[model samples]
Target: MRHRKAGNKLGRNHSHRRALLRNLVTSVVIEDRVETTVAKAKAVRPLVEKMITLGKRGDIHSRRQAAAFLQTPESVSRLFATVAPRYGDRQGGYLRIVRTGFRQGDGGEKAMIELLGAEQELGAKQQKRAEAKAKKREELERQLAEQGGNEEGGSEENA
Candidate 1:
């Protein structure tokens, strides 16, 4: 009975499924990587590749088409500017999906979907984020130490 109906329903109706895919595509376009359920990732892969294909087109009609499908203007611009350019020489297979693990709740399988040529950029961004977090932690610790020292000095003075 289920013939020619290619594509997972994901238990959602048509509109909801379209919206979910649109959001997922937008997130992947903006972040260059997104962790999602395996089915969702697989569903979004072709959509993202299509968007990149539109980006490669790099015309007004393509831009409008991308804007209509994607969530934000920023994603459209990034697709046209950053993501599309990276895949200019390549033909297809713009995105890759890697199985990460299963979610603790409900035991759903999780996978990471990412643009193919964005490994270096993603790595650098993650490293920068880690360094910033470390710097903030050090600053907070230094402030706490200074506060403790000041309190000790005051207590000694009172004594």
Candidate 2:
């Protein structure tokens, strides 16, 4: 059986795999969410946690290390500024992987990897959207009611 193999190969050579992981980590840091295969998500988790730990350190050396690993300069800054602070009092487990079913073509299992507390932001967005939708619906109904009233008044005057 397979033994002593600590990581998944992910069908890529060393350089390609490292690049992929860095891009995925950067995406997750900036957007706080990423949809990828379960294998990829699992592989990206540790690296991302390490970055967050570096962010927690908030030192020049840590920043340099993070910038070296991550894809973009912006992502490096965000990791230290926003993402790390969100988990200030917490210890580990900064990410959550939710299975989003399988890819249709290859049937590979897909998952969404997101930061733990992103749901609060998502919830606020949903609430705002619902409020706007309700306001629009109310306006439409009021317009319809006014149209019906006008039509009836006109018909009665004609009669």
Candidate 3:
């Protein structure tokens, strides 16, 4: 029979599936990324994208709508204030999915779902930290070189 159905049931009823998707969407919004089953990631991608699209409006109705769907004021605020603004210039395709092998227990496929702009921010922070470390290392090397030169000159004078 299973002819007209397009989406996976995931062994859950209608309400349960909706709830699961909502929770997953909320987590993704709050954390900007999450490791989840590949099927779940594919299922929730459009929902998260639509929520971000709603957030782009930045209005009362849109906020309320997103809040209603996400069920948390904090997540809603973050989506509007932080997540959405980053994607304001871009069109669709707000989420990225990367396959990360399989779960060891049941051997289910695992994947990482992440918002596009969030990675850039993380990378920038890492880059800044790396740059700072590199500068400190260079300074230490210069100081050591100068000390070695001074020691050589002092020893020459003694000789």
Using TM-score as the measure, the top candidate is: 1
Question: What would the per-residue lDDT of candidate 3 be over residues 1-159, giving only the tens digit for each residue?
Answer: 988987878779999999999999999999888999999999999899999999998999999899899968899989998999998899999999999999999999999999997978768768999999999999999999999999999999999
Q: Arrange candidates, best lDDT first.
A: 1, 2, 3
- lDDT for predicted candidate 2 compared with the true structure: 0.95
List runs of model 1 lying over 4 Å from the truth: none
Model 1 lDDT tens row, 105-133: 99999999999989999999999999999
Q: How far off is residue 20 in model 3, in Å? A: 0.8
Tens-place lDDT digits, model 2, residues 74-159: 99989998899999998999999999999999999999999999888768877999999999999999999999999999999999
Weakest 10 consecutive residues of candidate 2 by summed lDDT:
117-126
- Any runs in candidate 2 off by more than 4 Å, and if so which? 1-5, 123-159
lDDT of 3: 0.93
Residue 63 displacement in candidate 3 (angstroms): 0.7
The estimated TM-scores of all candidates read: 0.96, 0.76, 0.74
Runs with alpha carbons beyond 4 Å of true place in candidate 3: 2-4, 123-159
What does the lDDT read for residue 155 in candidate 1? Answer: 100
lDDT of each: 0.96, 0.95, 0.93
Error of 3 at 104 (Å): 0.6
Q: TM-score of predicted model 1?
A: 0.96
